[model samples]
Every structure is written in C-alpha cells, then in structure tokens.
Target: MSTLTFRSVSLRYPPRAARAGVGEKLVLDGIDLQVASHELVAIIGRSGSGKTSLLNLAAGFLEPTAGTITVDGVPIEGPSADRAVVFQDDALYPWLDARDNIALPFKLKGVPLAERRARAEQLLARVGLADAGDRRIWELSGGMRQRVGIARALAAEPRFLLLDEPLGALDALTRTRMQEFLLRIKAESGAGALLITHSIEEALLLGTRIVVLSPNPGRLTAEIEAGFNAEVLNGASVAAVKASPIFKRMHAGLTGLIHASAEEEIAA
Candidate 1:
C-alpha cells in the first residue's frame, strides 16, 4: 500500500508589494499528516485555518516553507499523476464532451486514440456515468459534472486523491447523494483520499479518520477515528448510520470542538 506523508510541514507567504511593511503571514505550522491507500482522511477547520493550503501543499502547487511531503518516502517534487485533485468547481473542459475530457489525460501521454477512448468509457462507467459520456459539460447537472471530473482524475490512475471541497457547491440533497458516491468511488478506485471540508458531519460520515485544525497559523489540534463510513460501506444505509446515537454524539462533539477552537482563537 502507498502512503502520503507530511512531516512538520509549514507554509508562509510574504506580504504582497501592495501591503507595504507588513510581515510575512504564516499559514500552516508544524503539520504532520498521513494517508494510506486504504484510508480517507478528512480535514476540517474554520476559515483561515489553512485547510486549502494543506491540500495545495499535498498537490505540490505550493512547497512548504519548512518540512517535507512525501509519497512512499520520496519527497514530492511537483504535481504528478500520483496525486489527482478535484475542486469544488468541477473543473471540466466545456469545449469537450465528458469522454474526451477524461481521454485528455491519455492523449497528453500520447496513448493511442482507440485505447484512450476505451479507457475513458470504462472510467465513465466506473463513476456511474456510463451513458453520459457524450454529454456536454454545460448540459450535465452539478453532480453529474462532478462525477465526470472525478472520472477524469481517476483516468490518471493516481495513488492519491486530493479533494478540495468537491461537493461544497452542490445543493443539500445533491451533496448528500454525492457524499455516498464519494465513499463508493474512493473504495472502488483504491486511491487514498485527503478531503478538505467545512462540514463536520461530512468529515465524520466519510472519513476513516477526521483531523481538525486550529486557526491562526493552522496546527493539528485533534484527530478522531470514525467508523460511520465503514458502517455505511458495510451495508448500513446512510440515513441509518447518521441516525444512530453514536453518530449523533460524535457529530455534536465535533461541532463543539470546532466552535470552541474558533472561540479560543477569537479570544486570543
């Protein structure tokens, strides 16, 4: 199994030229995180807690000011097919249909057209978009577009998925449905997932492990093991698992924890 590791990672940004005399701002500090091929780790925090920064670091869009990020012990040099990212905007190419969008990755690698088309078809089916391959990006629903985006990511055969609030833009009912879809897709893809979400419930429901960060130079403040995802994956319905007493208790506790952290930050 592959593992993505972040050790004592920190990120800081210098003040913009327009902000004269302002000191550099620290975004993340001393972060240590890991995600294995078999795990989905959800990270939660309030605004300015560096949640997106952390994901960006893992994606190699930005290097840490200090510390290292590695996959299977080798430092990440830059973005690679080893880690695929999904954004909230469902970043699909409108000019192309879903199939061609997914096939674009293969085309870049110079794969034969027929082979790429076949692989793209397989991925569309995998994401439950079997008949939507020819659908235009603008013609699909928000959820459908997101599925296509995910299918495109999987076409890269990445060892890890870096999700930056991929479902945050969907409507409530759609978001709920997509949550389950994410669980199933993550399992089927066999790629470790690092999800950044603002919803404590989302983190609890989907994460094998939930990590909380405290703001003002974000730091890891809490890590909780969650079994709700496993229960749902093991045949318990999402509604049933969510309605259970344990699930309710954990959700409430996580809510309190995040609120308390924010309060503390404000008081400081």
Candidate 2:
C-alpha cells in the first residue's frame, strides 16, 4: 500500500529582481494532502491556481520551499519510478512505435526484450490499444497518442500517478469515454492518482475525493468526499452513476464552489 503525503508544503520562486517588477512569487502555500493506494484525489481550480505546481512538486521536478513531501514514508528527492506523470502534452518519442514507447521504462531497467514486449502488449490492451501496439507515434491521432502516454505511465507500475489536464485536449464525447477508461484502470491497478483538472464534472466523476484550491498562491479551499463512483464499484453502470441525482447535486454544488473561489480571488 503506497501513500503520498505533503505536510504543510509550500513552494515559491525566490525573490527575483524586477523581471516585471513583480518581485517574489509564492505559488503554493500550506498544502497538506495525502493519497493512499485505494484513493484518487482530483484537484480543480481556476487558471494560475498553481495546480500544476503542486503536481510538479509531487513528481519531484521541483523542491518545496517549506515542509516536506513523502512517498511511502520516504522523502522524494527526485523523480523515481514510484511516481509517473502524464502531462497535457503527449511526450512520446516520434521514432518509436506505441509498444516500444510503453516498454521504454522496462527497457531502461534492462528487462529482456521478450518480457518487455509481453508487458507492453498487456498495458496496450489495458489502455484500449491492443491492436495499435505496432503503430508509430506519428500514425496515431492526438487522443490515441494521449492514450499511449497513459499506457506508458501504466507500464511503469508506479505507486502514484500524476495527471495534468491529460484529457483537456479531447472532445467532450471522447473525454467522457476516457474518463470511464481511467476509472477502469484505477479499479484494476489500485494505484493512487492525483489529477489536476479544470473540469468540475470530470473531477466529480472519477475522484474519490475532490479538492478545490484558491487562486494565485494556491491553498486548499475545499475538499469534498465525492464517492460518486461508489455505486459503479458495486457493478452499477457508469451511465447510471453519471445520471444519478447525487451526481447532479454534487455537480451543481461544485460548480458553485468554483465560482465562489473565483470571486474571492478577484476580490483579494
């Protein structure tokens, strides 16, 4: 059971002398968050809310100015296989085919070709790309490439999955289907996920817990126990859960919460 925890973590860009005369920039402050293997936490807030900053910190791309971040009780000093990130931009190698991209991490660890191929094939199928394993990255569509990116992340078998608006580029219908796909993946892998998204409905649909952050120097403004997928876990259809009254209520409430946060930001 892997867990990621942040204890009063704060991140800031040290005072810069008059680039725009803005001076110091505090991106995030006093963030305390935890994600267990059994839970997926979704963070939503307005643009410039430092949502991506929080994910970058967790991914070990940046160090916190204060407090600490730990994965499975150990300090995260740099990027490790324990945390896998999927950015909005698909970062697949253009020279490689889908299967090769997914198997890259295993290859880095010196796994034999036969084993890596089998593992990559399994992950491709898990991401709904079973037949597209050999297709070159250039041959895939934007959404398909994104799926391969996710498949690559899955192949790492990371304890924590960090997603930054991974589906923000998809059409509405495709986004919905991908949401279902993500839920299935989470069910199967039980890996803790931290998804930073701009969509309230998306967060409500997939997150076990939804967190809202305030703007500028982001801070946790609200946390909601979504549990919207609870019924889905009991064999209820995704469509049924999406159309349920509870989902509608929570959707409206979250929409309001976002608006309230935006107003607060403007007023501050």
Candidate 3:
C-alpha cells in the first residue's frame, strides 16, 4: 500500500507588495498525489513551479496552507525522522568530517557512539566515500560532498526520502555518475523517494513515474510512466535506450510540455 498521500494540497506564499494588488501568489494548488511504499516518483517542472515546495511539504519542513498530507497513515505536522530530505545545497556541517556528519543524526537520537561510528563508516563506504570519511566538507569535491549528504540522509534509515535537485550543482559527468549511484542505491535500499528536479533527462533516467506540474499555482499537468526496467543499470546498453522509441517519445513529450508551459506563463 502507498505510504504517502496529499489531497487537495495547496500552498500560498505570504502576500508581498508585488502580489498584494493581485493576490497572494499560490505556489501549489490542489495537488492530489500518492506515493506507494518503495516507489520512486519524480516531480518535474520549471522554476517557481513548486517542485521544491512539494518536497518541503512531504519532508514536513512546511505545512500546506490547504489540504492534508499523510505519511505512514499519520498526518504530517512537522519534520520527523521518518522522512529524510536532501536539499539542492549539500548542507553538510562544514566543521564536521563526512563520517561525523553522517553520524550526527544517530548522535542526536542518543545512539551509542560506537554504533553510530560503525553505521556512518558503512554508509560512507556504500556511497563510495569510504577512504574519504575523515575528509572535511571543504576538502572534498562537489560530488563527494553530495555523496556525504546522501549518506547522512540514509544513516537515519528513513521510510521516505525527499530529494530536491540534489544533483543540480554537479558537472555533467558527475551528474551522470551520481544518477547511476542514486538508481543503484534506490534499487538496493527499497526506500520510497520523491525527487524534485528540473531536468527532463534526469527525470526520464531516474523516475518510475514522471509527474509534470504547470507553473502558476502549480498543478499537475501530466503524469507519465517512464518504462525503464531495473536491468537498465546492470546492463551496459546506453545505445539501446537512446534508440528506444518509447524513451525518445517520453523525452520529447516531457521536454515539449515543460517548454510549452513556460511559454504559456510568459505570454500570460
């Protein structure tokens, strides 16, 4: 059964001078969504389309101005350990090294120091930063820092993961590598994930279900299943997917929808 649900969800930014005469800008409007247990769903939209806001809502960082959001049959009130969020910025503590940063959550929860250290070491290794565990945030590469952030999130062992453009800052090569890492991690972890991203290619490559949102007062514009099987990772057949009719169609359709929506906003 699906563990997350949002019904008639809407969010409004507080009225500012720019929007005061018109109205409070509605960021999200009537978002009705459900993410089943162990399902990886990607939400795609242009900037200001409320993709990050949606993740924030799910993470319980922000409460919806309207409607209900529930996780594990419980209505979400505020941030909880049950849901872990990895933001666009790699928010690792600068002073703490990767291992300590990953262990922070466990430490906060009063887990034994030995246990926290062992789990942190395991997660850092899992994320391919085993030898770099003692490296400070500033010392590591951008991709390595991002991996540390991911490891920290996983250390909590949350039921649901909310990712807000976690790979947005990486270079193209790094982004592709991170994408594969994320796919592999998801496959192995079986943790439900809701990823908010602007990249159509990323969405297509990563999502089981891709959701498109229309900008002004963000509403779901379309939902499409990205028909990628688990084998895509293990098999070394990139050319096949590029040549695939279904993949091409999805790429074109999602790209077109995003552009069209942006154009509509401009014309309005």
Best by TM-score: 1
Q: After superposition, how far is residue 198 of candidate 2 from its true place, in Å?
A: 0.4
Clashes per candidate, residues 3 or more apart or on different chains: 0, 0, 0
Worst 10 residues of 1 by lDDT: 13-22
Candidate 2 TM-score versus the reference? 0.94
TM-score to true structure, per model? 0.96, 0.94, 0.92
Q: What is the C-alpha RMSD of each candidate to the true structure, in Å?
A: 1.6, 2.0, 2.3
Stretches > 4 Å off in candidate 3: 15-23, 234-240, 266-268
Q: How well is each residue in 175-200 modelled by candidate 2, as lDDT tens digits?
A: 88788777778778778999999998
Stronger candidate by lDDT (2 vs 3): 2
How would you encode candidate 1's per-residue C-alpha lDDT over 133-210 as one tens digit per residue? Answer: 888999999999999989899988899999999999999999988999999999989999999999988999999999
Q: Which prediction has more favorable TM-score, 2 or 3?
A: 2
Q: What lDDT would each prediction earn against the true structure?
A: 0.93, 0.88, 0.85
Which pairs clash inside model 2? none
Ranking by lDDT: 1, 2, 3
| Candidate 2, poorest ten consecutive residues by summed lDDT | 14-23
